[model samples]
Target chain A: NAGVTQTPKFRVLKTGQSMTLLCAQDMNHEYMYWYRQDPGMGLRLIHYSVGEGTTAKGEVPDGYNVSRLKKQNFLLGLESAAPSQTSVYFCASSYWRGGPESTDTQYFGPGTRLTVL
Target chain B: AQSVAQPEDQVNVAEGNPLTVKCTYSVSGNPYLFWYVQYPNRGLQFLLKYITGDNLVKGSYGFEAEFNKSQTSFHLKKPSALVSDSALYFCAVRDDILTGGGNKLTFGTGTQLKVEL
Candidate 1:
């Protein structure tokens, strides 16, 4: 399985520019998430979807929007990019398991490096 | 709310020597911990997870983590380190709370491991 894959491995944009990042997973996962990685900051959650057609805000959702139109795909949109938004973006997918004993492990994509000037 | 801490910014070890990366987490309930590795210019890769099992869990590439409930710590260890093992390591935690249809994980600032020859 290809697991999870992200589009536009690298991108450079001027301030206020817009773009969309596409994430696809072949694992048939019920949950999808977007995260951004910065130096000394690890990875922070941006947004996530429980299933198709569902979305929710995460820890760092400002300046970013997400949509899960299809189960295998999730899209993150930047309405107007800012210099603070320049970071390595990652998409991950995982299957949902209920109850305390259950475990949910996420699989991550190769990441999209974005630079805002 | 959940959070993870990797106190060390980096760790250095000579090839064939033992190496350790420390991690501690905070959560309200039972914690699900995980370890991931990121090579340069690559996305994070799942190395191991601790759900409900023995305290010592072995994972890919001969890495293992010890889960200490009392200390709220899950430290990754490798008996004999190789230069190829040099990378950034992340420790994450998922608590009992369910949000957006699944559990959300909090990651620590990564620890860079340098295995020298």
Candidate 2:
């Protein structure tokens, strides 16, 4: 299984430019999430989807929007890029079930490094 | 709100020596703790997790973590470290809001482990 994979391993954008990130998982996970990693700051949640066609705002959702049209894919969009938005973005997915057997361990992708100038 | 803390910015250890990575968490209810490692410019990889029973949870790459409920801590340990094990380690806790769906995770800043030869 390829597990989770992300597109555009590296990107550089001018301020106010727009772009979208693609995330896909082959594990048939029910939950998908996007996070940003910065130096000295842990990975912060950006947005997540419980299932296909469902999306929810996470801890750091501003300047970012997400769409989960298909179960295997989640897309994160930047309407207008900003310097503060430059960071390494990661996508994670997990198969979660209720009860004791569920460890809720998330599997992450390689990550996309974005730079805003 | 759920949160995790990795107090150390970096930890150095001689190869073949024991290694420890500290982690503390704060949450309202049961805390589902997890450990992930990230290689340079790579994504985070799941190491181990603590869900229900067994305070000592073993995971991939001969790594293990001790879950201390009283201290609200889950520290990762390796009996004998290897130079290849050097990477950035992150501790995370599942958000308690598992009501509707989406098992979101809160991650720590990260601890850089340096295993010297």
Candidate 3:
């Protein structure tokens, strides 16, 4: 399986510009997440989707939005990018059939390096 | 609410020596913990996870994590350090209270492991 993959591995954006990072998974996972890793720190969640047509807020959801229009895809958008948004973004996906599988492990993508100037 | 902590910002070990990256977590109930490694300018890679079964879970790259419920710790260990293993290591915990399939992860600040010959 190709597992999870992300687009635009690297990008540079000016302040207030908008961009969307795309994540695709071939594992047929029901859960998808977007997270950002800051310099010399751990990752913080930006948004997540349980399944198609559903999205939810995460640890650090502000300034970002997400859409899960399809089961194999999750998109993260920065409507108004800022310097603070410059970070390494990662996308992960996993399958869950409820019950004991609630704690299923996640598989991550290659990540997108975004630099907001 | 659940969280993970990596006490050391960095760890340096000589090649062929035993190595460990410390991790401690906080959760209301049983914890689902994980370890991941990130190379330079790359995404996070899954290492191992601790669930219901054994306390010691073996993961990729000959890495293992020992889970201690009493101390609420999950430390990553390698019998002999390798320069190729040099990377940023992260410890994460699944949320104990989230309903359904969310079980979003809370990660540590990360520890940079450097193995010098």
**Best by DockQ, which number?**
1
Per-candidate DockQ values are 0.81, 0.75, 0.70
- Rank candidates by DockQ, best first: 1, 2, 3
True contacts kept of 2: 0.89
lDDT of 2 by residue, A1-117 (tens): 999999999999999999999999999998999999999998999999989999999889999999999999999999999999999999999987865446577999999999999
Can you write out model 3's per-residue Cα lDDT over A37-58, one digit (the tens) per residue? 9866689988998899999998
Cα lDDT tens digits, model 3, B58-94, are 9999999999988989999999999999999999988
Cα lDDT for residue B41, candidate 2: 88
Question: Residue B101 in model 3: shift from native, Å?
Answer: 4.5
lDDT of 3: 0.91
DockQ of 2: 0.75
**What 10-residue stretch in candidate 2 chain B is worst by lDDT?**
B95-104
DockQ for model 3?
Answer: 0.70
After superposition on all C-alphas, the RMSD of every candidate to the true structure, in Å, is 1.1, 1.4, 1.4
Candidate 2 residues B15-54, lDDT tens each? 9999999999998888889999999988999998888888
**Candidate ranking (TM-score, best to worst):** 1, 2, 3
